[model samples]
Target: MNENKIPEKYTYIILTFTLISIISCIILNAFLFYGFMASIIFSIYLCRKSGFSIIELFNMIKRGLYECKSLFILMALIGAMIPIWMSSGVVPTMLYYGLKYMKGTNFLFSAFILTSVVSIFMGTAFGTISSVGIALLALSKIFGIPNYILLGAIVSGAFIADKSSPISNLFNLTLETVKIAYKEAITSMLKTLLPTCFISASVYYFIGKKYSVVIENSNINNFMYAINSNFTVSPLILLLPLSIIIMLFLGIKMLKSVFLALIAGIVVSIVFQREGFNHIINAILNGYNINTNFVQLNTVLVSGGMISMISVLLIIAGAVSLSSIFQETGLIIPVIKRITSKIKSSEELILKTGLISGALTIISDQSVGIILPGKFLINKYKELKVKNCILARTMADTGTIIAPLIPWNVNSLFIFITTGISTISYAPYAVLCYVSPIITFIFAFLHKFQGRKQTKEIQVKNTIK
Candidate 1:
């Protein structure tokens, strides 16, 4: 075996053991802490056996800290905003109108697009799935739509938004990891995502064509009546978060964007809610609690307060820390090198990277698995004269699009927890998740639209120049 590479037998043993540890963590629902500690321990053990020292480990840890500091801060700020935004009724208002709209159209396509928009707004698949996804499941039950199709649409939409959202941690992480400009990353991602989204919407439209369940106008009237009676709904209230998005589009820092949004939320809640400053303060400290006659609307409104986000924030922090340690141990590098060495051509490189990313989302987390491999593979692609846009597009297509299919991944777990749906049942209908990888692979081999010169042509051009 090469000194840098783990022996194949040992690699298998290590992967098996690590997998067992991960499964245990998931079974115990200790995904945040114990899973993190396990990763750290595994990395340290591997490094020690490879003759790395404690001092080197510490240095690597420091480097990881430096690398992830901005992202960590951004995550914290976004977490803080979740509660305030919730309490201010901004998210609820959005959901209320969103659900109202879904009362008419093809529920599958509507669910997908609505959830996609909400997830992009919320900056997380988990948030979108937990809130809107749960509501969609309930609606499916009420309207007699098949749960599998509803679940599939929800998963597809949330992940697509999560992959594309500028505020999303995964999106931010990818931009940073690839050292690409945010606009550049977004632009590159849209090349693949836009087409996939159109195809996904078309598929959903067809899948839902046979079922026409008209929600009684009385039922829709009652829901709307309940929403109007229970809470204050104002379009102006939305401007706060909308401004934050505008800032993001204008290239403002994510932390600043979230911080401003949180402040805006606080101001809006203090001014708009029935209770005065006292209630606002209590809600911020505890969480928003809305008592209403309409049970469904009550469930929708009574979310998002400071305390509500603590659990998620802690989970994210732990997950990011574990990812940091993984980066530090040189384990990821050796693994990356090993994987890339087997690729014989540019097309093989794209396909293998997409496959590896999709596979790792099953074992490891989504963004880490995808972007880590993506960052590693980029240089190899460049050597083959592949365009950077193609690499970025492929990453989004495979990474963002595939997460919900993995039973153990965060997106799938959140959906399962919130909707009480099986990953296996929903996986087949998550059209974008499966289709994106295939599309990327097809483009890579066909070189039909990648916008890059072939390796030989590039070499010849350089020689002539």
Candidate 2:
């Protein structure tokens, strides 16, 4: 038997496993990590039922983990970085100033914008929500803003950069799989991105102002005082964020840039915040905690460290292992062939991709969101003369943005655990999440305009030849 491809017979079992995962995670409100782990167990049971030897199964596990080691390492470092930066006063400083600037209609609007900025830089939705996202959530609470509005704003904002940021792993993966240049892909995507972002933000401005809470000057002063006392706040600390962007400019890879940023935060904490070497280490290994006596201040000003990310890491480890099974079973190749058989037009393929993207994210994780559906449809786009950029855009709209809308997706769970808001509770307010698909399909039909033009140009060029 060819080891690379699983026979068509196994497809039924695979579909069943996915169905169980979806129902458990969605309907029953089970944690994503546990649901994923259960799927891993189901996969192993299938291996055993097939009478596979112990050695073969073990090898599959190793291969899967090997594929995701870099991702896990990035999460670990980010986990450590968050805490180190928090103790170093980076998060507190950002919060202190962000609160000062974000008022009234700008509060929710700023949440979306601020998370967008940080997620673009961090390249992880979870990190953005855990760090600065945490601070913004707290501020919304202080202003007596409704959690639904804040949740929607923060989630929508956090994914903006995660989907499009050059450093984003998912974005990079989409480019590699779709066989498009980053410049070419992003240029095409910007056409859809600009309009959607503007409309989403405009609608949010009203929603934000509607929920805006009036705070007394005394309350603001006390809030600022609590943060200032915990960490030595100043403009100089802004260097940490600036340097990270500079590192990216210097061609330093994101993983290394994150490590360097972590070290920089530690140094700043030691020099300015008076964090001793031991305390810094503790925070990195465990988590950073600062108590400001006031309950609101204490809640907002604390969090970070490597251990904080362990649960989500486990979920990814489980998800990646299952992804490997799908690969080794050789299901992907046949799956793609079958999908390509029925799709006759670019419009049909694009619309189907948009639908599959959300379903994949719900059944699997963010990576699976793109890998499963995109790979299935990749070659079809080429045959139909659809720009690969259209494929990438569809994936971003459905897969990337939909992650936080489902409680079972790792990204959404991370946000919920960090901010204590359920995905269902805030999904309506997450205008961008739902709005993206609308714009994506609208442009999908409009794409025929550009497609016709390109096709005509190609035909003329071929006639000349």
lDDT of 2 at 196: 82
Deviation in angstroms for 226 in model 2? 2.9
Cα lDDT for residue 281, candidate 1: 70
**CA lDDT, every prediction?**
0.66, 0.74
Per-candidate TM vs. native?
A: 0.76, 0.85
On TM-score, the candidate that comes out on top is 2
Q: Evaluate residue 437 in candidate 1 and report its C-alpha lDDT on the 0 to 100 scale.
A: 79
Shift of residue 390 alpha carbon in model 2, Å = 1.7
Q: Who wins the lDDT comparison?
A: 2
Report the alpha-carbon TM-score of model 2 versus the true structure.
Answer: 0.85
Q: How many residue pairs clash in each candidate?
A: 1, 3
What root-mean-square deviation over C-alphas does model 1 reach? 5.4
